[model samples]
Target: MTGVEHEPANERYAYSRTALARLALSDELRELADRAAAGVPTTNDMWAQPGEVVGDALDLVHQAQEALVRAVIYERQKHTSWEAIGEQLNMKRQSAHEKYRDAVAEWQLALQEPHYPAPSGAPVRGLRLHEAAYAPTTAGARLDAWVHEHIPAQRETEHPVTGHLPALSTAEEMVQVLDALNHLYGDSRTPPDPKARARVIERKAALLDRIAVEQGRPEAAQQAEEARALAAQLHAEAAQAPD
Candidate 1:
C-alpha cells in the first residue's frame, strides 16, 4: 500500500485532536494557523509541499532543538553532570547525555580556542560623596540645610536711573516675554498697564520676526507677521489718541 493508504485512521484522528486542542489553547496561535492555512486548497496538502508553511514550521522546530542541544552541551562542560542538567531541563538523564555527547565535545574545543585583550579606555569617575546631597532623601535635606546655614544673604543695591525698578539684576526681557505670553493666553491674574502691554507686544513681535527669519518655520513666520500688524495697528490708534 502507498503511504496515505497505509496510514491508520486512529493516527489521523489523534493528529486532528491535538491540532484542535492547540487551537483552543491560544487565540493568537489559532489566528496565526488560520492565516497560514488561508488561500491553500487543503491544510493536508501543505505537508506534501516541501517549501510550504509546514516546512517553515519544521525548520523553526529544528532550530529551537539545535539551540537547546548547544545550551545543554555548554552546561555539561561546566562540570554539570548529565542528571543535574536533565533535572534543570525537565528531561531524563540518559536522554540528555545521549543527545548532547558530541555537542559537549564541540563546546569544550571552542572554549580551548584563544583569549584576546580588549581595547583599553578611560576609567569612569564616580559621583563624589558631597554630590549625593542632591538625592531626594533625608540625608539630602540635612545637607541642603547645612549648606544654606554656611551661605551668607545677598545684599541689595540701589539702581542709579530708576529706584522704582528693583536692583535684583533679573532678566527683564524674559519677564516681558512671559507677560506677552500671559496676555496672549488670556491669563488676567497679573494685570499689566496698557502702555506696558503695547510695548511688550511690539518687542515680542520683533523677537518673533527675528526667530521666524532664522528658523524658517511657516507657523512662526505667520505669527510674527500677525504680531507686527497688531503692533502697527496699536501704534496708529495710540498716535490718533488725544493727549
Candidate 2:
C-alpha cells in the first residue's frame, strides 16, 4: 500500500478497490445468501456478521458508481439535457450541471469523436487518477471537499471545513499544499512540505479562529488572532525577502 496513492478514506467511501475487495464480507456471507432466499431475517448472528451488511452495501455502491460514470459518458455524448439528468439523479438542473460540469467538460475536450477508438468501459477512471495526482487547479479540490461534505449529510457526521483555496496560487504552490496535505493525512511516515509552511500556518490560524468564535472561547480566539498576525508577518517578510 506504500506505493499506492488514492482517495481519502472515509465512512462513505472505501480507500481503494483492491482493499475493498480484499475485505471478506463474512464467513456467514453464504449463509446470509441462503437466509435471503428463504425470506428470513438476515441480521440474526446465525446468518449474519457485524458490519458485513454495510460493507456489502458499500461495495454495491462502488459498482453503481462505475455504472453511473459510464452512463454520464453516454448521456453527455448523446447531448442529453441537464434537466433530464437532474430528474434522473433526483436533483435540480443546476445541481446536476454543477456536479458533473467538470467531468463533462473533460470528456468533451478529450474526445475528438464519439467513438474515439472504441472506448473502454472504465476509461474515465484513468483520467480521474491523473487529475487527482496532479490537480494543479483548485476545481478538483473544491469538488472533492464538496462531495465529501455533502455525501455524509444523511449520516449526521460533520466534515471538516476546507476553506477556499487561494485562487492566485501557482501550480508549484498547489503542489506544495497538496504535498503537505498528503504528508499530514495520506501517509503516516512522510514529512510535511517546507513550501507549505506559510499556508499551513495561515490555514491553521483561520480554522482555530473559526472554532473559537463558534465555541465562544474568547481566550482561544485571541490566541488565534495573534497567531494569524504572526503568519501575516512571516508571509510579508518572505514576499519581500524573495526566494
Candidate 3:
C-alpha cells in the first residue's frame, strides 16, 4: 500500500462505522425529503400510474426505516443506553432493545471474526466482511468527497451533521490503521508469507519515520526503528516460504 495514498485528514482513507452509519442515515433522510417535496401529478395524470408512484414511495420509506436502524446501531456503538435510544425513537427502552439487539449482536460477532477465508487460492489472505459491507475504504473517501463537493459550507461550521468526522488519513491515524491492518490480516510474527508482510511493515516504518520528523516526536522515530527491524526480520523469513 502506498503511504502517500492517505494524506490530509479531510481526504479520509478510513472510516469508523459510526461515520458510515451517519452518512447512510443522512442519505436516506434526504431521499425521503426529496420525495415528499415533489408534488403529486395533477388529477388525470396522477391516476395514470398510481401504483408505480406509490410503490416507489413505499420502497423509499422502507429504506429510511432501515437507515434509522443503522443510526441506532451507531448510537449503541457509542454506548448509548437502550433507554436513550428508545427515547429518541419514541418507544420504550425494552422495545428498542428487542428491535435492535439481534443486529447489535451480529455486529459484535463480525468484529470477533473480522476476516473469513476467501475461496481457495485467493490473492489476499481473506476477505473482511464488515469492511466490505459497512466501512470499505472506498466508501469513506467517496462519502468525504461527496460532502465536500455538495455541501461546501459544511467545512466552515461545527454543524452536528458534518462535524466529528475522523481524520483517518493523518499521520497519527496512519499508524493506527497499520496496526489494525496487521491484526486483521495475520499475526505479524508468523505470517505465511513474509515478502508482502515485510513490505507493509516497511511502509508503516516509513510513515512512522515521517511522523517523527514532521511532529518532532522522537518516540515515533524509535517506533520506526523497531518497525524497520521487524521488516528486516520478515524479509529474512521470506526465504523459508515456498512459492
Structural similarity to truth (TM-score) of each candidate: 0.25, 0.28, 0.55
Clashes of each: 0, 0, 0
Rank the candidate models, highest lDDT first: 3, 2, 1
What tens-digit string does per-residue lDDT give for candidate 2 at 82-134? 89999999999999889878866654433211122324663433232222212
Ranking by TM-score: 3, 2, 1
Best by lDDT: 3
Give model 3 RMSD, 1 decimal.
7.0
Global fold similarity of model 1 (TM-score): 0.25
**lDDT (Cα atoms) of all candidates against the true structure:** 0.44, 0.46, 0.61
- Candidate 3 residue pairs in clash (backbone atoms < 3 Å): none
Q: Mind giving the per-residue lDDT tens digits that candidate 1 earns over 1-243?
A: 011211122121112211212222222222344444453556566456666766666655665564466456445534578999889878899987877787665433322211122236523322211111112133223333433443334113222112221221124333536644564446467554444456557666666666667667668667767877776777777777688
Clashes of 2: 0
Cα RMSD, model 1: 33.9
**Which pairs clash (backbone N, Cα, C closer than 3 Å) in model 2?**
none
